[model samples]
Target chain A: MTEQFVAELRRRATIYWEKHPFQQAMLAGELAPDAIRAFVSNRWYYQASLPRKDAAIIANCPVPAVRRRWLERIAYHDGAAEGEGGMADWLALCDAVGLDRADVLDPEKVLPGVRFAVDRYSAFAREASWVAGVASSLTELFAPDLMGRRIEAFRTHYPWIDPAGLAYFEKRCVQAPREAGHALEVVLEYARTAEQRAACADALTLKCEVLWAMLDALDHAYRGHR
Target chain B: MTEQFVAELRRRATIYWEKHPFQQAMLAGELAPDAIRAFVSNRWYYQASLPRKDAAIIANCPVPAVRRRWLERIAYHDGAAEGEGGMADWLALCDAVGLDRADVLDPEKVLPGVRFAVDRYSAFAREASWVAGVASSLTELFAPDLMGRRIEAFRTHYPWIDPAGLAYFEKRCVQAPREAGHALEVVLEYARTAEQRAACADALTLKCEVLWAMLDALDHAYRGHR
Candidate 1:
């Protein structure tokens, strides 16, 4: 039953943003520098919001053992110290991609549409049941493959970007599978009822919508218009 | 008993960072602009951490009614939209105090000690009981008085800064007492056992320690040393 449920969720990846036109333009290296800059500048808001979302999941979780495991995600993104972790790596990517790190950090450039989608995800994490919030993070199940493809695309098609900028993707390629596997196990264990399973699937769908909406906004802002 | 508990927590204000030498130096106008800049930069981490902390408290809270009320804190800091609210106001303060908004947002200037203290508070909110986490926010109970005094000091002593920057403090002066009152009511109503009351007091003390530690790091960094 759990395998069937997981399979059902995976099948819905048809709606994932990996297939979005903006992502396609990115992968094809057809995006202009300004387009890529907009993507990076806007996505920084989403990246920065991850730790808070994870912390919310941990807070909502009633089990101590699960909370202990979930705590690592915060450390992963935030790092034990400054100038470390995925966020710093993303900033390096921003610098390598020719967007000013300060501008990205100021987040002055993020579009309203992008901020709305990211903030909605954070609010969902805070408001949803712990199992559903964990399920929402199953978006990670799709991340490793996309990250690998992204790295290859960057190297093959967008060689202008420094190789160091790809470090965040490279790290996530290793990190995402483990995270996704753990989250799936938790979801399968807790979401036993049909209603719970449906809720989990709905949460995953909402997450995909967020990613897709972010791309839609990016596409609207940068593609053809620029 | 509740009033006595509240009094005991209030008495701990003897150790609040407002009484710290660093704060005193700022009030006296004895600190250099660089020192004030460093304080603003480091404290930005704390201001930025507020919404996440509030979200954590809301996530952990079991009652929907309380969660609904608790949700307001996030909105108060994050605002109904970007370029609004207390975080934006703090950026204005940053601008007035001579730090670049980009630098403040970049968060590159955050000291290790300050980061540790702020991160510790966030973690406490995530891991501790929801009531305790809410209790920690009782520091706001002391905020209205401190904010009023700080604003007066900034205007009278540190006249170099633009008055617009004081907007955050002025706004908080009105907001804090109401927030603090709500939180105290929740704490007093819910924390029925002696043990729960003690835990609340402990959480408040830990919060005070975090603030003091941040100031200590600021004092060591920019006060006649580096």
Candidate 2:
């Protein structure tokens, strides 16, 4: 049953990739400022909502110290001061791409699929076992490298934007690895049974699909607007 | 304004602390199996569901490579193999201290505050703006040190449990800092305005209070019995 689930999740990723417009653009070599702007504007909902999920994880921890450590993640994303951190940088990204900050934050522009995928993830956090919830975050393990590639792509391929405007991705170059390393240790140490291992795998696949699906939604909405 | 908010949050923490009975014990050196057991069992809901929250975070990222890296955190918590991350270890601690896993997962047995706190966090995640949502996760910056203190306390003050059983806190010795570091970088780099900075602070305070309140509630509910 687990194997079947894993296989299905894998299939979802493949299909998602093939049909996703953003993926198509990257492959076909035509990622314009419009696409980047659209993507950032649409993804505002995601950046806005993630920490509370991290908070749930902290709250569930039995140990104060563990909870405290997890809780720090909340602060980091929140920023120590005003107008700094990845979230702010992301907002800045939208601004750089000519998005109206107020309209973007209004969150009415987000597509249904994007909302559904994110809401499903929230439900997963609220509904799944702690390990399963944490397992879903395992995707962080792969983020640093990805963020690096993204920065490179942005710099080399998309040069219309100011260098400072790309600070959000720059932040990830340092942040993703730090976060993923800790999470990886937790998973490697906590999954104590075969069922757990399978669940962990599913959690990763689930996250992957959700991510892939978001890009799919963007691609769907973004088709030929330029 | 930021200082006022921080002060307000701290004041709330103070009030919460003054009213909390169990925290008094931990502070006054009240370490016992029953107290620990209560804490562990009640915490199951939060501990078990964290990865799902992380999944939400990853699912929401705009970039593909970013999504992939973020997914690793889910795998860590959900675990790829047996006896690995924080959740399973927490359950082990519960069993060691005399908790029934069924009862832990069973809503009927959990304290109302536990349910409320966990659910509120989910709601916050669901409702917060993208930046606000990510900002809320900043609490993890402080996790590693707390985890360190916990392991030593268990090893030094509570000798009834096996060293092997202490693996949960022990494992976090490495995990907390790594994750916290990444999250901090993201928040610091992304938060771009004073208003957003303040918002991030509030989100973190809310997250911290949620955690502290859970302990407060537990202390109030179980002090007499423990």
Question: By TM-score, who's the top model here?
Answer: 1
Error of 2 at A133 (Å): 1.7
The sequence of per-residue lDDT tens digits that candidate 2 reaches over residues A1-226 is 5445444434433433334558557434476667777777777777766665665555344433344345446556655455755677888888776788888987578887888887777667656666666777766564435566666766776677677878887877777777766765566666667788677778777877787778878888777754
Q: Model 2, range B1-226, lDDT digits (tens) per residue? A: 4445445434433434323566546534465777777787887877766665564454344433333344456556655454566677887887776677788768788888888887777667645544455656655554335566666766776677676776777776777667656655565555567777666667776777777778877877766753
Recovered native contacts in candidate 2, as a fraction?
0.00
CA lDDT, candidate 1, residue B167: 95
Question: What do the candidate models score in CA lDDT, each in turn?
Answer: 0.83, 0.64
Candidate 1 docking classification: incorrect
Compared with the true structure, the alpha-carbon lDDT of candidate 1 equals 0.83
What DockQ does every candidate get? Answer: 0.06, 0.05
Name the runs in model 1 displaced over 4 angstroms: B1-226
Question: Would candidate 2 be rated incorrect, acceptable, medium or high by CAPRI criteria?
Answer: incorrect
- Residues A116-183, candidate 1: write the lDDT tens digits: 99989988987889899999988879655899889998898878889988899999998989989999
